[model samples]
Target: MKITGYRCLTTQHDWGRPVGDVNGHVDSGITEVPILVLETDAGIEGVATGSTHDVDRLFPAIEGEDPRAVASLYDRMIARVFKSGHAGATFGGIGTIDAALWDIKAKLAGEPLWRLLGARDRYVDGYASGLDIALDDERLAALYGSMAERGYTSGKLKGGRDVADDVRRLRIVEEALHRNAEHPGLMLDANESWHRKQAVRHVSAIERELDLVWIEEPLRRWDAAGHAALSRAVRASVATGENLTGLEQYRPLMDAGAVDVVQIGAVWGVTHFLRVAVAAHARDLPVSLVGHTADAAVVHAAAAVPNTMPTEVQDLGSPIGVTIDQAFQDGGIVLGDEPGAGIRIDESEIAARMAGDGWRSAAGPHVRSHRTGLRLATERTA
Candidate 1:
């Protein structure tokens, strides 16, 4: 079957609280870059892309490609636009298409993406990603207490600004976990806010306090050497790569042996991220899907990867995940035997919420924002 058409949807929400991290806090409501729908000729359509900015520009390249030729289409799109610096958006745009194509292919073949990706297991373990930076130790303890009840034996805390304050927060979470007799594993994400010296020092101090599963993006994204050095200095594993664009950029970090865990995102779409996972597996490294605040797609991708370590379930923002038709059980997610990515979009709901807003360009064909969101649609579309 061949591609038919595509649409982009962007939605905005007023956040109830500030989503804080080392980068500062977002007090306003959050915006969602949800992927809409892609139509195909085989009488099958699916939502493979989740909340992205430029779903419109991705249509042309994929409008006529065969659904089964996902890898070829992916390579062509990457090679065609490789020199234009459109890697991020191109990857994002094509990712939706590739996912849809995979959905169609899998449906035709009567299999799930994971089975098609050759995984023997459908259930993968996950960790709760707590987002209660504004809460005091008592409240934070209560929050973590809830996580333990949910069956998550692992979790990650957002850190960066105040080292002492973060240390206290970690203590609270640890105490709560132990109080419940859960012995849940703990991890921290600095979001590239700390310097090498600060990260090394802070990680060392907290290492003995909490059994840190890993430390994510403790320093800037480009500091491969620093990360390598820091990895060598600390007992806790270093994890990164949520922001790195493509395989070329990822190669250096992997080659340097800088990170013990690689974080891939579905925002780059499912296909590209899978390729990265394969590369990581080749190096005998573990990977975790970065929490982009979207659900199912990344969770499914992580499940499909043979070397996946832990999937992330964020605590902040929307009630969408909790309201999904499927259930997240036993500290893991199972993509219940649905064809394609197995996510059904509530089109009427999405359109009404995103009414009066569609694809609009402030710059050139390769430069546009699908709506008010900051997602850069940088691909030249015919």
Candidate 2:
């Protein structure tokens, strides 16, 4: 069936705890996440969220097109945006549509997205994130102490401003997890707040103390040499790729042996997300993905890849949690046998929330962190 139409939408919800960037540069947080819907002539529809910007312009390229020709359509869309300087960024929109197309494919096949993609594990190991460096010890304990009860075995925290403060925050997260924190899978993200030397210094001081899994965006996403340096200097591995738009950008980082773990998502789409999975697998490195406000789309993305576990989750208690049959258990997330991404898009609820003025106000078309600089760190590079 051909594509009929699409709509870009946003919904706002609270993090339940403080939301902040890595490095503590911006601790206060607000939410205005993006979503997109692609409808087809056959009454099948595909939905994707967690940042589908400029989805309106995508209709012209894919409207009246076959969703089954997802790869061809995706390539065409990429070529269409190549000269306009939006090809990479548009993939956020294109990736959503690509995911929707994959949903259509998997639905027609009567299998879940992970099965369609070739399942690695029905459920992947997950870690609790959404830990704000800005949170004081008491609030930190209250949040993560509860997270431990929710079945998370590992976690990452928003960190980076000061090395000493970063260590202090890490200690608190460890304590909150109690026994689970023993082999602490805690990771830190500087959100690109540190220069290379500063990242090395901070990680050096805290790596042994907390035994961090990785240091994310400690230097900068693009600084291959610097990342390699920091990775060499610290016992903890250096990781990035959360904000990269395509594989071309990832190669240099890999070439430099710049990262020990690769954290990716919203880079291109589930298609490229899988591509990143393949790339990481070829290199024999560990990979993880962004987990926030995602329902089934990301669940399938994680399950289809091996060696990628403990994805960063936004919350266990979210309004969107009810949209799917999958649930978090045993420190892992498992999906059920539902066609497509298995995401039951609660359209009415989405519509209600999209009515931003009523229950809550959406952030904006652009990504915004309470602190201005944090937004720049995560923007997709052309």
Candidate 3:
């Protein structure tokens, strides 16, 4: 079916609560952006992109293209903007449009996007990603101690500041899990806050304290050579690429032998993720899907790839996967047999939240953190 129209819906929601780590106090907050929806002639509409900027500019690029030509359309968009940088807000815009096109195509074909992507299996495994980065020692241990009871055998912790303090935090988490015989696998994310030397020093200490499965983006997103050197120096497997856009950006990391695990976001759309997956598979690298708080779309994409290791289940503010209509069993997430992405947005709830004055009232003062240089500013409600 042909494309009919596209619309942008901007709304706000509390993303997550704060958790403590070794570095200091850390919390999660909400930022507002437009979610793109694509409508087709066959009376099928799909949620294309979630929380993206520049919806106005992306509308004209794929307005009349066939929904099934998602890959070709993605190529066209990339070629049209090839001269532009592949990271940051511009690539994020193109990613939104590409995702919408896939949603429309899968809905039209009357099959789940995973089936369309040639997935041999229907379900994939997942890991529990906690949000207790701000808790003290006692509270942090209790938080992870409870997570083991809930059947999460793998977990990720946040780090970026003091090396010794971070090691203490990890020691507590490991001891709590070890007491129960759960022996949960652990991963760490630096969020691109450290330099090469600092990452090496801190991650080496972490490896000694905890049996880390992987260390994610300890340096910067663009540090291919440094990642390679660090991978050689540390025992923890190097994992990165969550902030990356396309296959071209991914190639250098692979060629450099930098990353041991590749993390991809489905919000970039099915076609682009699949392209990256195929390349990663060629190099025998394992893949982990990154969550943008909401990740049902990526759940299906991750299951289809044979080399996919585990999907990251973030314990953030609101439970998007649990609240939505899709089926989540055990620690793994499963998509419905419905066509397209197999999920629907609750438009009434979205509208009500948008119309209310809650978000405007919740907008707090902006505070910048010294460690990550991230400004935790309250976004204006529109």
Candidate 4:
């Protein structure tokens, strides 16, 4: 089927999820953000959203291309654009297109995306992220407990502000998850909140006490050497690369022995993530998906890849207006036979949430006092 057109809809909200808190960096002030739908002359449609990829610039390149040839089309688009002037240009743009194209292709084939990707495993483990430092102890308990109730036995909390606070929250999370599993898988994200010495000292202190599944972005994303040093210093596995743009960008961290689990996410879509996933498989390392706003959604990429560890489902318990046709049970999320990512969103509810009272970024850790909201858009994902 030939591509016909596309649409972009976005709105702002008053909720935010941080990488870490109090000390961690990378604060974002986004909310609900935007969702894209690529329409085809054949009546197939694809949905996507993530990162600030220049989607506007991409439409012309793939306007008439075969959506079924997603990989080739993606590669062609990359070759056509010799250089990405901005940081997320390559990943944000390419990945979203790839996702939308995959949606169209999967619809044309009358199969779910996982079926095309391989369907080797029908389920991937999920973990609750976003125990933000900004939240009080009561909110923290509610969020984590809410997550566990949704059948998630594993969870990760934002750490790296204060040793005492981290320790205290870890216990709180442990209490929550233990309600289900005798031994729950726990993780942490410091979001480069600490200096090298501070990170080492902090992780070391936690290592002496807690059993963490992994520590995410423990240092600045660019700190390959520091990540390596911290990886060696900590007992927990290190997962990085969410901030890094592409495979070439991630290779250095892999080579430096900095990341135990390579994370591939929104910026690069399924095609790029598959490249990294295949490479990680060859290296015998685990690959994880970083969290995203649509309930930490892992759109069309999970089922067929190798060396994939438990992926993220950040807002599983939050009343985010987006959802998918999947079941969360047995500590894993199961995909439905729906074409594409199977995402369902309520634009009106999201607009209400965004227009409510405060303004906050959905992806990163930033909040502002903005009073106005984006003009709402009509819902379109089928």
Candidate 5:
């Protein structure tokens, strides 16, 4: 079927609790969710989560092409944005269309995306990530305890501030996960808030008291040398690359041996994740799928890969107006027999909530504080 046109919809993910990391948070615990719908001439439509800055500029690349030609269309879109650079929102835009194209391809084949991609089982292993830096101690325990009850044997906490507090909070997560497994895996995300020596010192102190599986984004995402140094200095594996937009961005880190666990963000679409996973596997490295806010479509791609460790489970529910054909059980995500990526959107529900619920704060988690790396630098020298 040939691609026709597309439309965008607005929705929101209500966490019902605060969600943030070292940067900051929305006190209301709500954020906007953008959905893209690709209309095809063969009476089939494909849906994807997240949006790019400009649809007009990118749509022409795939306008009359076959949606089933996903890889070629994806490459064409990248080339379309070559001079301007497809980083940030533009890459996300390319990714949004690419994800929708994959959905269409799978649906045309009359099989779930995972099955079409040759996965033996529909189950993808998962770990809980609360984005809980803004949450208090009582709430933290409650959230993780609930996830443990859902059979999650691993959990990642948000922390990069004080060593004493980080240690204390990590134990809380460990205790929560201990309810499910004897040696539950625990991870920490510094969110690119620490410098080299600072990340080493902080993570080293926590390692003395706890057995960490990994420490994520300890330094900046592009700091190949710093990440490699941190990887050698600490017992926990260094995991990063959730913020990177393309394959080229990951080459430096891979060459430097900086990342022990390669991470692919769900928002970057299926093609990018699959390519990156294969690249990481070629070098004998394990890859992990990072979840986006209320989006888990990439789990299908993750299941098709052999070296996938555990995909992140950021939320138990989906955004308003969205329904996913998957269930979380046995400490993993089980994809249903849905013919596509398993996401269905209700336009009426989104239209009703579009007016008031989807607003984001200007100073949200995406913005880093001026004192983020500076405070740790001062401490390291002192």
Candidate 6:
């Protein structure tokens, strides 16, 4: 079936508690989920529930083409924006379209995406990540305790600003996950809020009290040398790459032995994950899937990849009008036999709740504080 056109809409994922990291938090615990629907001439439509910006510029690349040619169309989308570069929103648009195309392809084959992607098993292991910097102690414990009850044996906490506070919070998560596993996996995300030296010191201090599995985004996304140095200095594995948009951005870090766990964001689409997972596998590095709300599509890709670590579990539920044919059980995501990614969007329900993101707070975590990186200098002088 040939691609005809696309439609876009916005929905919301309510975390039920404030979610944020070192940078900012959404006090209302709600964030907007962008939905993309690719219409086909033969009455088959593909859906993607993530960022779908810049479609006006990128759609022409795949227009009138067979959706089954997902990879070629993906490359075409990238090449379409060659001069402008595919990073931020442009890459997001490509990722969403690519995911929809893959969805259509799998639907056409009359198989679930994991099966079509050659995965023998439909289960994708996951770790609970609360993005809980904004949550209070009681709320944090409640959030993770619930995940533990769901059989998650690992959890990642967002922290890096205050070492003492981070240590305390990590202990809370450890205690929560301990209900499922004796030695539950623990991780900390600095969210690119710390400098290289600051990362070393902060993580080193936390290591004194906890055995962390990894520390994510300790430095900026492109700091290959700094990440390598930080990795060498700390015992916990350094994980980055969530903010990176393409394969070329990962090469420098891979060559430098910078990242121990290579992370591929779910928002970047299925093709991107497949390519990155293969590349990371060649280097013998473990790949992890960064979670997004309604991330089932990429989880299918994660299941087919041999090098995947536990994917992140950000939200336990779907947006208001979206339903996913997957179960969060056995400490992971189990896919249904439904064709494609198994995400069904109810346009009427979405229209009824047509609320734009109301979680807007000027001082929230979404806004990076002015003193974010500069504090490293202040700490050194003091």
Worst 10 residues of 1 by lDDT: 373-382
Model 6, 1-382: lDDT tens per residue?
6899999988888778887777877778777888999999999999998787899899999999999999999999999999988898789889998999888989999999999999999998999999888788898899999999899999999887787788888889989989899999999998999888888888898999899999999998999999999999999999999878999999999999999999999999999999999999999999999965597789999999899999999878888899999999889999999999999998898888755454456656657777887764322100
TM-score of each: 0.84, 0.87, 0.84, 0.85, 0.97, 0.97
Residue 369 error, candidate 2, Å: 11
Error of 5 at 342 (Å): 1.0
Error of 6 at 321 (Å): 0.5
Query: Which prediction has the highest lDDT against the true structure?
Result: 6
- Model 5: C-alpha RMSD to truth? 2.4
Give the C-alpha miss distance for residue 6 in model 4, angstroms. 1.1
Every candidate's CA RMSD: 7.8, 5.0, 5.6, 7.9, 2.4, 2.3
Q: Where does candidate 3 clash, by residue pair?
A: 16-317, 19-132, 19-133, 19-134, 20-132, 20-133, 20-134, 20-135, 21-133
Per-residue lDDT of 323 in model 2? 66
Inter-residue clash pairs, candidate 2: 22-159, 23-159, 23-160, 23-161, 125-310, 126-310
Where does candidate 4 stray beyond 4 Å? 11-30, 292-299, 317-323, 344-382
Model 4, residue 333: displacement in angstroms?
1.3
lDDT for every model?
0.66, 0.70, 0.67, 0.69, 0.88, 0.89
lDDT of 4 by residue, 282-364 (tens): 87899888764452234447667767787777664333466666776766677787776776667677666554312233323
Candidates sorted on lDDT, descending: 6, 5, 2, 4, 3, 1
After superposition, candidate 2 runs with Cα above 4 Å error = 22-30, 320-322, 353-382
Model 6 RMSD vs true structure: 2.3
- Over 4 Å off in model 3, which ranges? 13-16, 19-34, 83-86, 138-146, 175-181, 316-325, 354-382
Better of 1 and 4 by lDDT: 4
Decide which is better by TM-score, 2 or 6.
6
